[model samples]
Target: MKRKWKFFIGGLVVVAALGYLGYQGFIASAAYQYELGEYLAQPGIDASQNVQVAGQVATGSIEQKSFDLKFTMTDGVNNMVVVYQGTVPDSFRAGGEVVVAGRRDPASGVFEATQVMPKCASKYVAE
Candidate 1:
């Protein structure tokens, strides 16, 4: 009976540890999506937390230096500069819509993008 009780307690401890890890993972991976205007309206956005912002690429704002890219995204009312170091998507271009995931710098206000997802123009058009 003592051996059974020890085994049960060990199993419970393992389950509790797994649950705690899962919760932490979920919290770390979860990111909130925002439009450009909505993101700009937030006065106290946490710079350490990852966030996603969607907007149209500003015309004449794309500049690339090898794998590094710099561009401006706008929501007609506000604009934000985005800097990313990665392969540019084939569909990305000026005037196209994009969603960028990363943290915004508190000092410079530039968005340091970890990922860029270009929205296909054709797929979003009304038939």
Candidate 2:
């Protein structure tokens, strides 16, 4: 009877630990997606809030610095400089589609990226 009780308690603890870890991970990785046009049009977006915005990198806008990277992302009509402090993706370059996840500073008007996800076309066009 004592052995059964100990096993039951241990199993319950392991399940609870797993559940808590999953919940924390979900919270930390939550992001909202917005197209470049839609995000630029919204004037009411709060700078303090985290968001994920997708756009193509503007030509001749990439500049690498010692500690950070800077570039302009545009939807053709409007563009904003993004400051990223993470390793850039190999597929990321000028004219490539990318999704940046982070918060924007109201004062600087620069998007501070936590993660930069580069997108590529799955299928190539036939010549």
Candidate 3:
């Protein structure tokens, strides 16, 4: 009876530890999504926190050099410069909608993007 109780207690401890680790991992991996204006309006935003900002690509703002890309994203009222080093998506273009994920540089106020996802237009047509 004592042995069984000890084993059960050990199992419970293991389960509790696993649950705690899982929760921490989820919190660390989660990125907050924000609109361009909303994000820019926040006071003292944490530069180290990973975030996703959605905005429209500003016309005549895109500058590409091989794999490096730089552009300005706008929410009509606010604008932010985003620098990304990766393959540009085919759907990405001036005036197109895009979601950029990464951390913001505190010194230069530029968003250093790890991923750039362009919003694709709907292919379906209604009669």
Candidate 4:
């Protein structure tokens, strides 16, 4: 009787601990996806939250202001301006597909990108 009670309590504690760890893992890693239109519509997005926005850079819209790079990204009708301070990838050219991860300053309406990755097309090769 006593042994059974002890085992049941121990199992319950282990399950609770595992559940807490899983919740912690989810909270520690925060990621959000935004389409260009949805992102533009939300003009008040918190700048401190890490986010990923998918879009294409508008052609002839890239401008560099000192260390900060600015450009207009578009998804058909909607357009949003983005800014980043770091070095850009060699393949990051105008009208190219890219996934940008960073924070958006609501005050300035500029996206400060911490990381930018280009999406390249996969070519098939005959073996």
Q: What's the best-to-worst order under lDDT?
A: 1, 3, 2, 4
Lowest summed lDDT window (length 10), candidate 4: 116-125
Q: Please list the Cα RMSD from the true structure of every candidate, rounded to 1 decimal place.
A: 2.1, 3.4, 2.3, 4.4
Candidate 4 C-alpha lDDT tens digits along 24-76: 88865686988878877886776777889999989999998666788888887
- lDDT (Cα atoms) of all candidates against the true structure: 0.95, 0.89, 0.94, 0.83
| Count of clashing residue pairs in every prediction | 0, 0, 0, 0
lDDT string for model 2 (49-93, tens) is 678999999999999876589999999998989999867878989
Off by over 4 Å in 4: 1-29, 65-67, 122-127
TM-scores, all models, native as reference? 0.92, 0.73, 0.85, 0.68
Q: What lDDT score is found at residue 33 in candidate 4? A: 84
Q: Highest lDDT, which number?
A: 1
By lDDT, the better pick of 1 and 2 is: 1
Better of 2 and 4 by TM-score: 2
lDDT of 3: 0.94
TM-score of 1: 0.92
- Candidate 1, residue 74: how far the Cα is off, in Å: 0.5
Clashing pairs in 1: none
lDDT of 4: 0.83
Clashing pairs in 2: none
Candidate 3 vs. truth: CA RMSD? 2.3
For model 3 the TM-score comes to: 0.85
If ranked by TM-score, best first, what sequence of candidates would result?
1, 3, 2, 4
